[model samples]
Target: MTDAQDLDIPTEPLPASVLTGFLGSGKTTLLRHLLSHPEMDETAVVINEFGEIGLDHHLVAEATEDMVLMNAGCLCCTIRGDLVETLRSLYRRRITREIPPFRRLVIETTGLADPAPILQTLMSDPLLVERFRLDGVITTVDAANGEVTLDAQIESVKQAAMADRLLLTKCDLVDQDRIDALTQRLAQLNPAAPILQVENGKTEPSSLFGCGLYDPASKSLDVQRWLKAEAYEHDEGHGHEHHHDVNRHDERVRSFCVTYDVPLDWDRLNAWVDMLITLYGQQILRIKGILCIAGEEKPLVIHAVQHVFHPPVELPSWPDDDHRSRIVFIVRDLPESLFQETIRSFNEE
Candidate 1:
């Protein structure tokens, strides 16, 4: 048996993305389209089978015993072990040349799976962290039934709230009015994530990936695109007048941005974030900000999903002339006043 200390781990970290959506939201369809692209040649896809009869495997072409190699050179496999084991096994196979080497991984979660657990695994597991990086989350929203699903299903709401890119699938089937309404609702739920339309699971690969602080292709941090604070700022100015009813399914979900004119105290800001996440991590779906810390010349980028946060990264310089700090929050059942009061207290001290 190979010794534990001798295990071969790849040095270069690969980007891994999570694809999630409600049932009948065209997640598998989207995956099929993505696998057909030439750019996806080196991607390893892991799909979760919810029930005994997993139809997604069959729907995807080029089936073997456990894995499928597409014509475009992508490797697709159903989840054999738990996610961690599955990932580790893939790494071993790559090391041994048992399978085609993959540069990236795409995980397709089951319809009802809460992405938080998977994210926690990716962030907290030391081995996985060293081998793979979280690129971002892409959530497919069914334009036809999305509004009703969001109305009745909390899972759907959480999926949308935590997504980095909101893909509205089946848009061709819906009328303009329905599309407009759903778009508005999704924006209300997550103002920071850009909404993209996908008809029959067709979308450019570039649009879905590269959402993290580090760009996979460029090997540099794209702080401006990663923060996207301007989206939330625009929403804050133009969209706040419309009030959602308490009876609405996503009434508790809120998206807003907070800006500070003066450079913030790093210790105070860190303490506030720690306390907030400690108390309300579950309710906080996502947080991203560009902060002008008092002592730092370059701005600091803060990112968090639920309770887990990536290490804060400092940019080389501010992206624009705006030197103010802007933080975007996508949270549930939390009032803006709570964050405002906390920041105010920190600034006062």
Candidate 2:
């Protein structure tokens, strides 16, 4: 293990990301490549089990203790009891000079696991909030079978819709036509997330990391990059409200971005959001926004997964000249027109 004293301990909470995918989606392969990358050298990984990830052979010839330091300087460990406990233990070990001073963390969930609970745990657990902030969710999709999987498995649809970055793996095994179809479907399921094609887990760490509002590499908040609201510009004029296919799992989902030119009253906005969550929390898969509050000069950022919202953060200044509020929503069976109409009704009231 790299000596803790030699590394720079993070002054702020470490950014943690969740890596999830359906069975045979190549999460382990992608993680293996990430662990070996030079850019991920200072990263620590928590997996459900060592046997599940099958990373033993790839690890360096180091002692197989609770945490193993890879040749590229990455630290790998299996979950201890539960996720919250494992993360707390990792932070404790890091501060006490027991393990390498890893700057970031990645948690790998089981193939069959629901990502919402994991995200909820990260957002709601006070201890985790104090030590680590959620970076984003990275999901892998198998190019050959993604369509079939999405049709049959609701969990796979959730994994895709909730991803901040979607990786299309095993592309070489399929034709471009299949890849194109899957890409279009994923875009429909989640417009804001960028879909990247991964060839046998060989991808740049930059593409997968820094997905959250904070850019660890630049040590600054990257609201524009995190939001990617432009992705929804293409979504406009597309009648997502009219499309309905209850048979297909992804057909029930809709993703869109809304912008408000007027500054919003904080209290009214809060009330509206509370009402929205209270009534449709389960259908609302993810919500992210950069708001222009009525009395605030700086932009306010809000993030939510299901019903759990992160504490609002105000930037020192707006990211750009545009002062309009932009909000992105990835929801299931929620009519886009109805959602926009609700906002209109609230604004009028």
Candidate 3:
């Protein structure tokens, strides 16, 4: 059992992770393997259609009309209505003892769906926000056909870029050279996210869960682990020439890290972030960082999906000795120099 098991009976807000990937990327297969684990028994899964997953093999008992208790003790539910309503209903049932009191949640999105909308939906809803906090996004990428998928569908590229954890699935079907190439590409696409090679969707639940800024078991902010800004420091920003020439649309997408050596002014930082998102919310895919505020001794952690920013939280103390602020951004057609200049101006003010 891992730290995720400590959350079996959530004392505070439960963490919810969004599982997204392209068609045939093995999301369902990964999810099925996760549910089969005894440690994942306390988790609840929400999907669009029950028929699509074919979970009858793991069926244990029916909890209600739309929800079922799985053989390993997870509660599986189909969306009764809109996502907001479905999540609300699940919360209600959990409190009322209508279903198992699952401590964590995993929402599976459709292959072609843009995950930003789903993240925004959860953030906009006050009730959902109070009951659940985003753990992180777990995206599955097929090693066999990931390159083709990314070339053909812009949505697949977004899915890979916005992920907090990238699961490289079907690696057994591809050669080392292909896997190596795809791995390098994924790193450039999302340097902050950790890529885990998964064969036949076989992966431990521990590796996929608890990827957010706050680690429940540690009871503190894990800034370095969450940010992984070091990845960007190592990136030389090369190799996009061939990709850019082939797929102009994906070439516009950029992932980079911006840093400030001095402590950031709270007021100015807020204004800068507000203006950036207000002007280019649709273009921005994900934003996350740990800040060293001017007046605050402890570091502040922030995360956002598109225009919706999670309320910034302050840690009791710094995660480590390093105190410089680092912010990572995944955006489309947004110039890095623009971000650097804007923030630089705000800092000067």
Residue 124 shift from truth in candidate 3, angstroms: 2.2
Off by over 4 Å in 1: 1-11, 63-81, 219-226, 234-241
Tell me how many clashing residue pairs each candidate has: 0, 0, 0
Q: After superposition, how far is residue 169 of candidate 2 from its true place, in Å?
A: 0.6
Cα lDDT of model 2 by residue, 220-270, tens digit? 666655577777765467644434366898888778888888999888888
lDDT of each: 0.79, 0.79, 0.79
As a whole number from 0 to 100, the lDDT of residue 305 in candidate 1 is 78
Candidate 3 residue-wise lDDT at 29:
86
| lDDT comparing candidate 1 with the true structure | 0.79
All candidates: TM-score: 0.87, 0.87, 0.87
Per-residue lDDT tens digits for candidate 3, residues 142-172, read 9999988888889889998988899999988
Question: So what's the TM-score on candidate 1?
Answer: 0.87
Candidate order, TM-score descending: 1, 3, 2
Model 3 residue runs over 4 Å out of place are 1-10, 49-81, 234-244
lDDT tens digits by residue: candidate 1, 9-106: 55668888988998899998998899899998888887776665556766765653235322211111234226777787777776666677788888
